[model samples]
Every structure is written in structure tokens, then in C-alpha cells.
Target: MADVHELQSLLGSGEELTIVCHNNPDPDCLASALALGRLAAAAGIDERRILYSGEITHQQNRAFVNLLDVELKPFDPELVVDRSERSLLAFVDHSVPGANNAVPEGTAVDIVIDHHPAEDVQARYVDHREGAGATATILAEYVRDAGLDVDATLATALLFAIRRETLGFLRGVTAAEYEAGGFLHGHANDDLLAKLSTPSVSGATVDAIADAIDNRSVTGSVLLTHVGRTSERDALPQAADYLVTLEGVQTAIVFGIIEDTIQLSGRSTDARINVGTVLNEAFGDVGSAGGHREMAGGEIPLGIFADYTSDDDQLVAIVEQVVRARLLAELKLSEEDGGE
Candidate 1:
């Protein structure tokens, strides 16, 4: 449990509070923010004044926010503004200051609650647990232990976050996570959970999947696919998961340029391969990358993609070659010998 006294003190001090999530906020990020905001409001804080960053991009995430009636004021990333001295900032789901879902540099953060690896933080209060499936799981504990009442909508929001971010508890989950999940499950709206879990399929998603399948190439046990450009960032991970189901395909790499960034999503069923390491080796020099052992994602800037566009096919071929090289290294296959 977090320090209730500290939270109480912040509330008593009457500080302006802002809650920020990472760019492209997912279900966990949005739901956790909503839960925290609800708690604060119940304790006499004004819900209308709280500021939130990022636009809801994923369909289910948008639905969760709408269903919960979570009120959030818009925040601008490009605007130069002062971080209120009396303002308290609480970051959820991430720790690093410049991480994908982090407050911009020079902004003071007062609290951080996360399930990712700990990083340097200026926040006075920090509770980080990588073992938890999602930050929403930890936040749910705070709500339940506070003996505060969460409405059915808020309950469903948290439940959806836990399920979506954990991939139905198949990734980065622990025993305590299940306990928290069970608690939320008891009170969460089953109908809303079902609807959010399976959002209506979009035609663009189908087109993207077809493009991925048509462009897929096999080299040894490595399956590589480049889908050129995409507006659906979330689909990259879905494509990665689908590609790994192919026979003899132990590792899968899906790459696509989205907006100004080139995204890479990698997945592996083999215990020997660390997709995180492969991601770091492949894009660490060019951009930022990180994740779990079996599933990892990375993003390189548009500059790198532009450089490769001189010969589009050659550039994709090079990416595949690099990924295969990393996979072969993981498999202990010599360059002279073919991949496993």
C-alpha cells in the first residue's frame, strides 16, 4: 500500500493536480488515471481541474473512458507552460521522465505508481512493482484498501485495463495480480467488460493483416514482415503475435512506419530467445526500445526510415537480415551454418 498520509497531506495542501499518461495512452494508462482521479474527487478534490494528456487512440480505450464518464481536461504537448508549484503530478504505468508515457523534462512530478522497472524519479512517493500485470492492478488495490466505493463503471474500466495490458494474464503477471483481478472481477460490470474486450473489428485492421500476410518472408525459423506504413500502432503487436503461430516460426518481427516513427514489434515462443535483447541490439543505436523476454517493441525515428527509402526493398531486406542475425546468435547458429 502507498502512504495514505502523504496523499492526505497533498489533498489538505490544496495543490493543483495534473495526471499524465504516456503518448498513445492504452487501457491501463487511461483506466488507472481515471481511478486515481475518482479517488481524489471523493476526498474533496475538484475533478474538473485535473489535467490529462494524450488522445485516446485505441477503440477499447476510448470506450472505457466514455463508459466510465471519466472527466479530463485537455493538455497540450507543444505549449510552453509552468508546472504549478502548488500542483501535484502523479505518473502512472511508467517511471522514467522521458519514457514513452512520461511528463516532459523540467516538469516536477510529485508521485509515481508503476509496474515497470524503476528509474530515477524526483517524485516524493514511488511504488513500483514489475511483478504486477498492470499498473491498474496496483491502483485497484489502493482503491479497495481505502474502503472507497468505486462505481460499476470505474470497476469495469480497471478490469478491462488489467485484462488488455496483461493479454488476459498471459504476460508479466504474478499471483497477487490474480488476487487483484479477482477482486475487480467481482464488482466489475460483466457486460461492459465483454464489450471492451472484443471491440468491433475495423476494415483497416483487416486490410493491415492481409498486407502483413502477403509480405511475410521466411528465413530459417525467423518470420519477417514489413507492412510499409500504418496508422494502427496497436495492430503491430497483434500482427507479431499472429505471425509466431506459423509452423517452425519461433520468432517473428513486424515492422511498419507509423506517423513519424518506425515501429517494430517482435515476439518469440522459444524460451532461449530474448526479444528485448534483440530489439536493443537492432534499434538501441538508432532509437529507444524495451519490454519483456518473449514480447518486445521498439521505435526508430522517421529519419532512419527515410534513409532506407532510397531502396525500399533493400532497406526491408536489411532489417530482416539484421533480425535473422540476432535470432541466429540467440540460437547459437554460426554464420556459415543455416539458421535453426
Candidate 2:
């Protein structure tokens, strides 16, 4: 549970508040930042800003920000330095300072309100509830208890964050999520929700999905596919999500060469396998990756093969072979069991 009064006290004490969102934020992180901003506003913090480390690559995320007119700034190192007596920095959705975000490891954190599983959190006021389906669900509790009038924009964002994080109340749905959804449902704008749910799917995304479908390999119940190159990093997760629904397939791994790195996304419905652990075991030494048991994503620098090749086609081919072999070995599937 969140220390509501302490959060308010921390906000009130600070002249300026910086709410930091995790890198490549999804709806849950963005909504949590917005809700925290509202709390800061109510607490008399005049200068409050939401900052994030990476690009908002997903279609729904871009739509969420534009349609709601959300004012977010890209994180800068200097923003961490302020001359004010009481400068507060809060982290939402992600806990570790330098792990998933650009914030330095030793930077002081005034408050942390999150739903992700974490440990050794060193914030003055911490509310890290892994039980909550979405961090927005925890924020909704504070907003309701504070007796603030929930605006339509915030309500819609919060409600959608909860729904999207839990996959429309189908996965990881808890009682708190249902309560949060119920609280925001009446105040949420149905039209805006409809628009946010169905944004303009990019041509790049369609092409990536087509590539994933065209080039797929299977081993036992595990499926792996790589989209050679794409400008859209978010397409990897969408492709993985689609592949998981294939009959007889319990796990799906979708990877692509985006920019200079290999972006990998995985989804698993197998009770015996934890996709997050498997992904980390497969690629954590060479890159950064981790997530829940059911879904995971990672990025590996192309520098691993920088001296080996320069051609785009050749680079992708190397990544495909390496990624497939690594995941297969991690999954404990024999080479003979693997087939396209």
C-alpha cells in the first residue's frame, strides 16, 4: 500500500518535482506518471514535469499521448541537478535507477510508487506492490482517497492502462484491478478510449508482421522467427503476441534488427517455462532483458558481430542464426527436434 500522506508531504515539500517514467514506457507507466503529476499539482507543487528515457514507439502509446495532449519531456542529465532546497524525483512503474532508466544509480529518489516486482528499493517513501495488476491501479487508489475529482482524460488513461496491462481483464486481473476499473469507468471517455484502442497501424508494422510470418521456425512447441530489419521496434512484441496464438505452440519468440541492435520479444503460455528467465539466460550476458514469466523483451547490441560483418543482409542472417540457436539451447530443445 502507498503512504498517501507521505506522498503528499513529499510533493508539498519539493519546489519542483520530476516524475521519471521507465524507458520505452507502455500505457501503464505513462498513466502512472500522469496520475503522479496530478497528485503533485494538488499538493501545491507548481513546477512538475514528467520525463522519460526512450522513444514512444508503439502506435497506442503515441496515440495516448497525442489524444490526451500529454506533455512529456525527454530526460536530460542536467534535469537531475537543481539548485532548489527541496528537489524531489519520483519513479513510477520501474524501481532501479540505472537499470531500466537513464537515471544514475546513486541519484536520490524521494518517492516510488510501482506495481512491478522489485527489491532493495531505496526511496524515502516506497509503495512497490507486485500484487497490483498495473501501477495505475495503485495510483487510482490514491486519487480516490484524496477526494480529487477525476477528470475524463486521467480517468480514461488510468482505466485503459489497467485494462491494457491485464489484457482486457483476461490475464493478471486481480480484485484491485477490477475496483480501479470500476472507479474510473463512469468518468472515462468512451470515444477517446475507442480511438486510443485502435490507432493507425503503421505500414512498417504490417511489413514486419508479414516478414515474421514468412520466416518462422519451430522446435517441439517453441516457435522462433526473425524480421530481418525494421524501423519500428514495437512491431516485435506485436509479432510475438500473434505467434503465441498458433495451435500446438506454447512459446513464441519474435526478433528483429531495429537500428543497430537486435530487438527480441517472447511470449509463453507453457506452465513449465518462464519466458523471462529463459530470455535472460539466453541473452543477458550480451545485452539487457527481463520481464514477467509470460512475456519478455530484450535488446542485443549489433557490436557483438561488428567485426564479423557489415552487410545488412549478412548481419541479419548472423543474428537470426545466433538468436535461434541460443534460445533453443536455453529452452533445452535438441537441434534434431527443431524444424521449420
Alpha-carbon RMSD, each predicted model: 3.2, 1.6
Worst 10 residues of 2 by lDDT: 76-85
**Whole-model lDDT values for every prediction:** 0.72, 0.87
Winning model by TM-score: 2
RMSD of model 2 against the true structure: 1.6
Q: Judge candidate 1 at residue 282 and give its lDDT.
A: 64
Model 1 whole-model lDDT (C-alpha atoms): 0.72
Model 1 residue 329 CA deviation in Å: 5.9
**What TM-scores do the predictions have?**
0.85, 0.95
Q: Candidate 1, residues 17-83: lDDT per residue as tens digits?
A: 5677766677888788887776677666673243455456566767766766766666654321465
Superposed by TM-score, candidate 2 places the C-alpha of residue 230 at a distance from the truth, in angstroms, of: 1.2
Q: Candidate 2 residues 1-340, lDDT tens each?
A: 8668878887888888888898899999999999999999999988988999879989999999999988999998778755355878889998888867899888878888887666689888899987777899999999998888999999999999998888788766789999999999999999999999899999988999989989988889999998898888898889988998998888999999877788899998898998888988899899978777778888888886767877988988888889988998899897698566
